[model samples]
Target: MFYSFIFILFFFNQVKTKSIVSINREANKIIKYVNNIPNNTWKAGFNFKSKQLKEIENIMGVLPINEKYTQSLEDLGFAIHHNSNNILDKDFNEIEVLPENFDASKQWSKCKSILSVKNQSNCGSCWALSTASVFSDRICIATNGSIDNNLSGEYLLSCCTGSCGRGCNGGHPEKAWKFIINNGICTGGDYGSNEGCQPYSIAPSAVELSFENTADTPECYHTCTNPHYTTPLQNDLYFASKVYTVKPKMKPIMYEIYKNGPVVAAMKTYEDFFHYKSGIYQYKTGSSKGDHAIKLIGWGEENGMLYWLAVNTWGTLWGMDGIFKIKRGSNECGIESRISGGLPKL
Candidate 1:
């Protein structure tokens, strides 16, 4: 009896230790660390604590924004460095008085796409989603709210081959913008809404937003995914007139969003960011994760700190109903580093 009792206690102890390790890997003990910070600007919670480490990595879905030229490309193919000198000239003079808090949705109340908060599901398609979102907004704004529609991120994810990078694994933000201008995309709504030419293939889920990168990027198709939708494939296509990367300065970025609606941006992600609940977020402490693309909608001041308002792809249940505010002007987490947007070919 004594031997059996000892064995039972040892087994339970081992199980306890394993459980602790799993939780740490999932949450990185971010809650404890974030709670300990003095005058914490943001609150931490178990937003992704139930997720596995691999799942968390999948959620941070953007490939490195700055990739080095590879010998493989030179050997098999050539890189296309589009001329940006003319496009960069499109930047407007510094606005004398920018609004304290300006939202694209509020500015363009007639453009319904501005109010959308999409979920990228378990796929690494943040690059495509943000690109499609910005394009949709720009289309509406450019056409004076006449062509209000959600362009298909699924088209970009599945059809934007080669330089755009792998669909679900990751993609480059600059290449994505270039793809929309070159190979136009069709309109599509969230998964299973059947509202457009090619709605997002990945189904929406409440609990499984950031599972491992198992969500399959659907095969590229020319026809509308929704059988009931009447728009022809070629007619459904929408193209951009111009695509360019905005300067990573606050003035340039603010001016772009103010004039052209939202712009897509890439930000370096850290483990602590998964637990973000509210307030102006600044990296407190955690291991650097990876790059993730997001849409910068506007800017505002909070508690003496200025922050850029951003939209996330992880669904409305997470992070201020799928939106967040990060410290602005300081390049916090490289949020101000790379911004890209385009004009819709209305």
Candidate 2:
């Protein structure tokens, strides 16, 4: 009866994606937001016994994920492949294609600004993640890397103009951008004290402040040399290629997250994501492919075992100090199928 899909909003009175409460408050409790992973439920049960886990381990050669049936862990967020070795389909190392040599001189003013995630679990905040990333990038563009800053994640989660709120479940990237372009975003330090997003007032008013702009994107002619750079986003480099342009209707927001860093993103949780403690995953019967709102920095093959170098918002407790590599290929997480684009556009 472990309907793993029974998330916080579906099972509880919670309106998805409200930010986490403080440590001393009940608002932030993962249980308050979501339901438990029922041991008897099929989604929770998975019909897999220790023997099966062992078999999966033997056959797949990795540990399977286990949960305390807790709400936070109930999502079974994502799973790495059991035998992950070949993740990238096409390999192109564009060293000289980078925008800049990743030097401080080339720093975008908004590079220092960061939007905080602030633990909006189970609310499907992919929208917020996308919006925040855009605003954060814009801050860099506006500042030209002169200001090492951090934006407010709580603000984006709670505000971000129109394209967000009520949790992480819904919103659009363009809407978020409209708000930022119309109204200057507050710095993370102004909200909390870090460069990431922070809690603010009149959460929804910012959405009303959203407006339009006519600034054209400068011709993307700048170039540099950095072996870490990838090109065209897709086309066999990184996961997949993402193309952007500032057309009459499409105002492509130009910003760089990492020259080449593996990004750890939250995925739509499903039955298979559980039993991932062993660092391997098997294809499941659902469309649980990664819908990464965030991008990783880079990836590497260790002894033929490829691991995605990713940055996380989990505060360094889970995975390697808030960073871990997922199984690359072999149908583990189907990451090969879920390619996010982040290449140098020189």
Candidate 3:
């Protein structure tokens, strides 16, 4: 009896080394978390202490109500700020944007059912993709409602001008337009994966956006480059362009073609992004990695505050379907603050 009692006591006294907290969020506001800690230890929970929580709450006492969110992306482990609140309006036109012609879009017309960011499992390539997208959208709209101008992000990654513009670090969107114009764009399939680019360039047009390398050819992303259907006009980026609607849309000039997807924005870092829970934010700790990229698709205002709807390449399991509302023309995002979003002619 004495030996059994001693063993029981020791078992009960064992120390807990670790715990896991699983956070499940639904619809950007519903969060259900389960703490898997040692039976007696409340270990698997918030990283902040109770005092810290109270302090944080106090610091954010004036913040907007965002109970729907339980995660706070205080940083990408870097710099960024608080929460979200916005509406999805279908008041825009119904035209899909892509490069000229009926090749790729036509080929995959039956199979590709309007892909959203929720379905795309992209990594940190949000910048390249978004840059490509914006260019496409701008061109499509400029061309009297055309929808076939999808250039390849893979192509940009390989043959873009300057150094390392196409890596995990966010690529320059405004610069991307210039590069595309000089080089002309390529089909997404022309390049493969995050590595390896084999472009099949087409004859240079009067309105070429950017071009591939000398070794590579420029193919259409959607594979629809019929001369009769192809528009000679290329998409270019404009600096300081006014926000036309409630949300200034990210012009699609690249590989992916979604009405609502991620746009390349300047966040402060290149690490694990913590979930953001607060409704309003300014900035935070960490380096300006310039490595991480994102997408901006929609936007509007809440309580007279401006916000832009955007997408992160992380996963649909994050943000609002992998999307969030950022302060439009705010200093937090490097765009509006940096150079006043000035884009030079290509």
TM-score of every model versus the real structure: 0.86, 0.39, 0.42
Highest-TM-score candidate: 1
lDDT by residue (246-322, candidate 3, tens digit) is 12233221112232222345454311123343332233322233434454444455556665555544335444445
Poorly placed runs, candidate 1 (over 4 Å): 1-21, 24-28, 67-95, 206-210
Query: What are the per-model numbers of colliding residue pairs?
Result: 0, 61, 53
| Candidate 3, lDDT over the whole model | 0.33
Worst 10 residues of 2 by lDDT: 245-254
- lDDT, candidate 2, 191-304, per-residue tens: 223222233221221211211221111121112111233421122111111221111110011112233222223334333432222232233333233333433344445545
Query: Can you write out model 1's per-residue Cα lDDT over 1-346, one digit (the tens) per residue?
Result: 9999999999999986787578666574677888778898888776653544445677566787334533432332222222223324344453257888888888988899876888887778999999999899989988889889988999999998567888888887677777777778899999888889999988875563437545787799988888979989898888887777777788778877887899888999887888888888999877887899999989989888889999988788778998899999999999987788877776
Overlapping backbone residue pairs in candidate 1 total 0
Question: Candidate 2 — what's its lDDT?
Answer: 0.31
Query: How many clashes in candidate 3?
Result: 53
